[model samples]
Target chain A: MARQTHTPSTGKLPGVEKCPTGIRGLDEITDGGLPRGRPTLVCGGAGSGKTLLAMEFIVRGIRDYGEPGVFVAFEETADELSRNVSSLGFDLDKLVRRRQLAVDHIRVERSEMEETGEYDLEGLFIRLGTMIDQIGAQRIAIDTVEVLFAGLLNEAILRAELRRLLRWLKDKGVTTIITGEQGEKTLTRHGLEEYVSDCVIFLDHRIVNQIATRRLRVVKYRGSSHGTNEYPTMIDQHGLSVLPISSLGLDYGASTEHVSSGVDRLDAMLGGGGYYRGSSILVSGTAGTGKTSLAAAFIDAACRRGERCLYLVLEEAPAQIIRNMASIGFDLGRWVDKGSLRFHGVRSTLYGLEQHLVTLHKLVSEFHPPTVAVDPITNLMVVGETAEVKSTLTRMIDFLKNQGITALFTSLTEGGGPAEQTEVGVSSLMDTWLLLRNVEMGAERNRLMFILKSRGMAHSNQVREFRLSDQGIQLRDVYVGPSAVLTGAARLVQEARDKAQAVSERESMARRRRELQQEQALTRAQFEALHLKTAALDEELHTLEAEDQTRRVTAAGEQAELARAQGADGNGGLSKKGAKRPADRYARA
Target chain B: MIAKHATSDTELLEEAARKAKHQKYVLRLYVAGMTPRSREALRTVSEICREELAGRCDLEVIDLYKQPTLAHREQIVAVPTLIKKLPLPLRRFIGSMVDKEKLLVGLDLIPRTP
Candidate 1:
């Protein structure tokens, strides 16, 4: 479908040829533009920018397309029209002087005239035809043609003449735009839509929540298909621009490149790298959870890479943000001075949601930055509802993605709820989400960060304690105590207690080893003393054996002598018994 | 029509009426080609000028078809539009000039109240 619209030469449908209006987003939505050589009725209430649209059509046609135009104003004089649009940089007077445009103011006063016989609006035709011929115009605008109804008394003649005028313009082959005031039950006050039937566009200006938003919608197109959504329109210094809520479809290309999240540990947690180059990143946390600091870091990293970065702040001034970031060791002001970072600080309630979106679009186009950061997008919810903010963000994200720009958005999630949930409901649209949380433990609050989800990478699921110091943001592994994840003072206290317990256990093991060595040494000493005693006893026994041997010999000799007196064989037996008796006595001793 | 009683008050009123009638009036009638409405408007305006202000009125009839540029220059939006020029307070009337009374009143030939 995109290819069909972009390549008109090959895929052009058999429909009315289009004349591009040269508007920002109008041509994209209208398929091409209003049907060429046919009248388009633009009807709206006062202050709804009907006249401005018609004037811009003529001016842009003359300037951009080189097609001369004629503007027949029934309400404002030519000078008034010129002066009114000068703010938009359209020099109507100059265009007229160049002979490229012709402005004719048609004034009809009913009180100055008396009708008695039949008449036609041939005089108006001659005037218009003469002007068209004078400028060789290819386009014309008749602003508020309904004023003719009030100026002329005869309705029947006016209606018939109006019909004839439209038909004549069509026959002339000049694309025409006729404006009318809105009516109660009809598209136009005098039903001008009935006459100019080829196309019709409606402009609406409505106020919601005290903010004004202008919208444009194509009500009908006879021979073409057009976008049916009510697109938001804005009239800024440049001109009127229609902002399509979203692109025709989600066909934007996804990039494979990676861009840093500015925090090393964050990059590690996000699967060894950073987010996709053209992806949207959401940093959601409760108040005072350092959402802005994370965004600033990302912007700083982008700037350091020599890529342009746009910082859109809604909650703080640029100077204040720079100062605050400087305290965190991030010199954002240096990037700003180097012209790599641009700060666009605006109050969230400064305008409507649509206006903010338009401003963002304009800024992005003007700067053409490769990276953008919107700090605390939650503040934008103050101006619009959640759905509106979400839609606006979706469009913003889509626009950035189409340009292959990496975007970081900070959202202030209310405390006590799931930190992963973004209140604006844009978490689904983000490709990467990093959640920051504050855990209160042991009378102190400590920040913790974890990658909630990273779309296309391996990420760590461990929750790390987030710390901010004079140096910068630091992420440390949170202590998993026996019962809970300890942080802040509790983690410090637990670490100290564990170290002390280890020290005491080492000291007790050393004392037990010393006691075992002393007991073994005492037992060895006792055994050595007993061996010495046995040695001394053996010496005494040897001495005693020497003496006993002599005594036994004497006894044996006496016994033998006695035995010799009796006989030789009995003496030998007695001597042997005496020797055995002496030996036994020695063993018993 | 005037009452000729010849009283002093009547003579003063007649003198004032004569002066008002002698005032010069310049009128230009713009028409588109020779259409029926343009022809009728031309005829009615000529008769009104001849009968009412004969020598005191100056009338010029312009055809938009011949002088198409004049339609834009004169700011003419309707056919058969008569613009009273030389009068101090210039006035313009549109449509076919068949209603002679209204034309006379617009031309200041008849008192507005009457």
Candidate 2:
């Protein structure tokens, strides 16, 4: 590839000053644009943008290089042609006033007009030649020379006349653009214009699948190199911009500045903090495994550095990623508004991979971003051939490296959970390989983000558990549970079961403590009741003793009197009313 | 481009007068077939020769289709083949007589500025 690079051989080349195509990818296709100062013919249908293209070429030459131009229309008047191309942003009038452009409308009326038998188109040639010299034109466009065929009734004279006109144009050294309406049967009316021009370009406006598409194909470029693929082009107020699908090798010199991947621990693993700038890093993982999250972390880090970043999301839309990343504390939208970041979400099936690459390259070139992130490069396999995708990636990686810009590409591993094989198959070309896998240790499953390879620096291979929380991606080293990969649905299920068991064990322990307290309270209540009964009996005995003392004196006198009453009562026993507890003993005796 | 109309003898005579005056070119409508289109081509060619090329170009009328021997003599393979004979490098144009403007352009008759 290096040997094939375009060597500078100025003198060997006939025409070198490139005519800026004013269309994307067009210059690259034409090997640095058109022949600088030679006539090229563009012929197509009435609405095939011939006039528009011609107008754009002339207008651009006037505006960009200060090279004036002349537009000679043999069909429509100058005003009509200018008005027709107004929507495409071609202002011929202003350029004319600036003495940078000249428009000529050749009107031929056969009625009441007489032509001498011997004649030549010397008059029209002189008119155009004067304008070219007056404006000092570097570009000239003549629309529909076939109109001459229409106005001239004698075919023999018209042919010789046209041949003369073309020769004159060539001798003038004005890089000319000759337009003709395409005939249904031939490329041109006389079918001989192709033999007279240096280059031929075909513009196609086709509707496929209900979508209008404008494409450009170079049928021929005499004595020069050109692309063969049908390139997609867009027509808007700015005229035509061809998509540069062929510039896969646009950039090559890359910088070596390192930036962290937003995870402090991961950064630490990456030799005291991050991957090298302009380096291609591949994050390979399976479904439900945090490949996108890790790539986001890298992108977020670049944004943190105030570096402009572009994210090409081939899998998910910007809105969806922004929403899902909210849990991980990464707000890409804010970075987008700050002008530090931009996210372009494109469908993998929308266009061929080369077109996608060209679009991305154009964006990167135009924006001059310091960092770029392509989420899941593997997704492109759905649209293009595998080999083509790989080549495109290689070219792109080369381009990024040459520019010295940091680039991270995420690739999804094949199904059956994160394995070594991936979809897009670009793992070998990457400068760094960041592998995330499920590791199970103990009863816990953990998903860990690890750097498997960093080409120029020391990197840690420790499988650290990566978690996406409200505060963003966090790595927890203290989780000493089972190390099973816990980044999937199955991990969540097992985790819930483990937590449930822990809660149930605590519930039973609380119930056992409640039962022991109930039994101890019952035994204490019985002992207290017995003590109270004994104290009450003691109090009763003291009261009885006091009563006995008070009645002692009265009893002696009563006993003398009672002796005579007792003898009358006969058999007077101890009164039961005055007996105490001790009387139970006496009764038993 | 409208089809050319028929020519009058006076117009033809007048065209001859012009061809004699200046170093202008002389033209002739040499056509084949008896169809109206062929007749139209012959008549239209003479009329134009009278108006534009009169007193300048000599106008000759040749019917090759009616006289196959003449067509063979001229080596005319296709009908409606207009030939410029007086010029050094004689040229021929072949097509239906439908395009008038094309005819003038082909003949190198239109006034050019360059």
Candidate 3:
């Protein structure tokens, strides 16, 4: 995805010029293709794609760089070579007819030939020169030139002639590629590497655990710095493409833009509306924890924004994924129909790790999508070891990032393994990690999700219950009981219990208010009865006081009358009586 | 037994002689200019044609330097290559052709030993 603008014509280097192969990743690794106008040796074992690589170089040179070439086929005939490479869409015959390419098949049968005396391979030189002049070719490919070793009996002569041939090609000033079969100790069976010393590349096809992977390496490049790492190469219907793993540098531009995650509450949990543009997001969970659903939601959101998206499914077919997503109200089928969403489904066992990576590269480059989703990246582990899968994913992530693409990858963790750990160990490469887990309580399993990490954003750390309903994915706050985090039926039961307790407490308070009112009424009635009794007692006392008053008044009046009736000394006696009566009345009062 | 062996040897010789008389040898010698090796190869082939094949041999010597395209057309990788085109099965010999026995055998004029 690192856009290669440094062509051979525009190379900035001063000393050694280059000839761009026009291959997908070859130019980037070779720092602008093989050394210009020099002989490069491409050696490999049988069926290691040596011939295809050489053929593609010539074909691409003619088609892309406008450099006429000649292909010297020593093993297969011109027709056979043409038929073999036709699948890659390279019409050799058409190129030949147009005088842009020439295919010369050199067939030597040892049984049909007799070597009596000394002979140089000047005839081959004449044939090559004539072909080169026929089309004014600037590039040449001698596919497996070692075939001469099998046909000729004299090794010393063949070796010397091959050396002279390479020197002759160099003197001609044409960029040439000579393929040789891998030898036991040397780089080539015929030791052709000893002759073409400008550049040497090795192609390897290895089958580990029944999965075949092809790798390419630049063994030596004189006066030029080239990638030394073994790059994973793949040959498909589109010809040979080498994946330069180390060519990706951490220098891609980081965008500050944000894209939605589809789930509103989940977006809120991410702090800023959504993820950063061109950032990688990891959604990891155990089985049935809605990892795929979460990824689908993101894809749906991206599609809704009118951005193209690519969904790579390894476990499920495109139709199956669409159908499953439809159950959650995601109309992915419509997006696919609208040409905004592309689904590429392939089984993990269908190819090796490198093949899958190459396929990913091919698809992405072809589709040029802004967003990509790889559902269950852990499924790739079936084809490769853990380290290989990690490396592949690393390259994949780097590629996506270099393209400024926002990618979402879902990882399926083992049932009992720690949900935070990914088997592929790609979490460190993600800009955001969303962990989903299953919490078992009340004899039922419930889904829970929490943001493990989100770089450059303040994300929520609180766990939330994850639900998938007919409407869509929903994130609800987890219920925290006295002992543990409650979910599902357990949370509902606890809520009901709390509500019942509140209701009973309110009812008891109402009963207490009625009882207090009855007690107040009883006290008031008892006091009223006591008041009436006191009033009656007061009336009786008043009546007794009136009777006593009357008695005292009658006694005083009789004393006064007696005092008035007496003569002479009666006045004094009457006065005395009055005083005595007054004294008696005062004593009674 | 010795007499029977001698009679069989004579019969085999007669059969070879009959095949050689009827068989026509069509030969092409590809060379790079008139180098010593090319001239020597031409001389050796002409001598064989005159002595062994007589009137039944047709030999053509091509200089690749003059007609360079023929090298690729004929699929010739070695210089002084003699191609027997008309012996049912084609055969080629590369070198100065100083060894006539090998050339005769390749041209199917003489039966190969073992």
Best by DockQ: 3
Give one digit per residue, the lDDT tens place, for model 2 in A130-246.
Answer: 677777777788887777666666678677767777666666666778887776787666665654666777776655433345667777886687887676665556576676453
The TM-score between candidate 3 and the true structure equals 0.86
DockQ of 2: 0.03
Put down candidate 3 lDDT per residue, A137-215, tens digits, no spaces.
8889998788899999888888899989987777677788999999899888878888877899999998877889999
Fraction of real interface contacts that model 3 preserves: 0.94
What RMSD, rounded to one decimal, does every model reach?
Answer: 5.5, 18.2, 5.9
**Candidates' lDDT values, in order?**
0.86, 0.69, 0.89
User: Number of clashing residue pairs in every model?
Assistant: 0, 75, 0
Which of 1 and 3 is ahead in DockQ? 3
Question: Model 1 - which docking category?
Answer: medium
Provide the TM-score of chain A alone for each candidate, in the order shown. 0.86, 0.65, 0.86
Error of 3 at A584 (Å): 17
Candidate 1 residues A150-202, lDDT tens each? 87788999899999999887777788899999998988888998887778999
**Lowest lDDT block of 10, candidate 2 chain A:** A1-10
**Which one wins on TM-score?**
1
Q: What residue runs in model 1 are displaced by over 4 Å at the alpha carbon?
A: A1-13, A415-420, A513-589, B1-18
How many clashing residue pairs, candidate 2?
75
